[model samples]
Target: MNRKELEQRLRQELALPYYNAKIAERDYSESEFQEMKAQLQADIEQYARDYVNESNANG
Candidate 1:
């Protein structure tokens, strides 16, 4: 997927609850959030690099 699509999918995935909540809302922990952020950042950078390389080769 493209960068925008990838990011949008990630956002949707984050909204999904991984655990059940009896009285409180379910959400990601600090480590989980950080891991997700790191993955997103890496994917974004890879996408940008790929795009640039493809454009250069096409030209």
Candidate 2:
């Protein structure tokens, strides 16, 4: 997915109000942004694995 879509998913998964703001107003530091990106990537990978596992189990 694109950056915006990823951010939206991350926001939902994180359930944090800080992520609900507009990108420009978020004003996160470089390190913080990197950390969030890493977390998002990890979460996405985990979700993919879960989906595959669930599908296999159901199939």
Candidate 3:
């Protein structure tokens, strides 16, 4: 996928209900929130990469 599409996908995937609850309840401090978001983004990016790799390999 292109950069734009990948970014959009990441945003959509990052909107998890568990995280939403944490944000709504003020469960984490600002730095903590940022750290969590950063990690989640990294994880999502890796997952996307893995999915693409698998698809290419299968074909």
Candidate 4:
């Protein structure tokens, strides 16, 4: 699927009660665990930067 469709699906799924638990478990892996954690950390940092930029723009 495309980005828009994928995001829409994610938004829909996130509305469910068990979304957080299952979503975290879906990334489960024994060997690639460190890589996943690093990737997720980078993703969070990038998002924070984007949010800061948007806030500065609005302010």
Candidate 5:
């Protein structure tokens, strides 16, 4: 995807987990909350890598 597309995708991808994480803080256990947070971080890293690789390829 292009940079703009990537930005939009990243925004959508990251939003739900963040919203859930907010709710999860109250409902999920400590380990569960940590897992959710870790997954979000992983998702972010993967998206960054994909965006970089895609951008490089497009260029």
Candidate 6:
């Protein structure tokens, strides 16, 4: 998804109500979720780079 779609989906997911209190529950607001979405996207990019580097190095 693009940046706008990610931001929109994050807001929609945050609006969902929680049915149970679990320790693994995320307690972030809409803004925080947006930030997390960006961070995760960045992480995926970094992971791909790392994988490519490792593969090239091994080859």
Residue 9 lDDT, candidate 2, scale 0-100: 58
Q: Write the per-residue lDDT of candidate 5 for residues 1-59, one digit (tens) a residue.
A: 33334334435655742332223113344555456557777987999999999999999
lDDT of the structure predicted as candidate 2: 0.65
Clashing residue pairs in candidate 1, if any? none
The whole-model lDDT of each prediction reads 0.57, 0.65, 0.58, 0.50, 0.55, 0.57
Estimate, for each residue in 1-59, the C-alpha lDDT of model 3 and write its tens digit: 43333344445657753332223332344555457568878887999999999999999
Error of 2 at 37 (Å): 0.1
State the lDDT of candidate 6 residue by residue for 7-54, as single tens digits: 456456544233222223434566765677576557668999999999
Tens digits of per-residue lDDT for model 2, 1-59: 44565466567656644564345534455566668767766876899999999999999
Models 1 onward score TM values of 0.57, 0.57, 0.57, 0.51, 0.57, 0.53
Among all windows of 10 consecutive residues in model 3, the one with the lowest summed lDDT is 18-27
Model 5 lDDT at residue 11 = 50
Candidate 4 pairs with clashing backbones: none
Which TM-score value belongs to model 4?
Answer: 0.51
Residue 23 local lDDT, model 4? 36
- Cα RMSD, each candidate: 11.2, 8.5, 10.0, 9.5, 11.5, 9.3
- Please provide the root mean square deviation of candidate 4 (C-alpha atoms, Å): 9.5
Q: Per-residue CA lDDT of candidate 4, range 8-51, in tens? A: 44446434322231233233343444453455557668999999
lDDT of 1 by residue, 1-59 (tens): 43444344456655533322222334545565567557766876899999999999999
Best by lDDT: 2
Off by over 4 Å in 5: 1-26
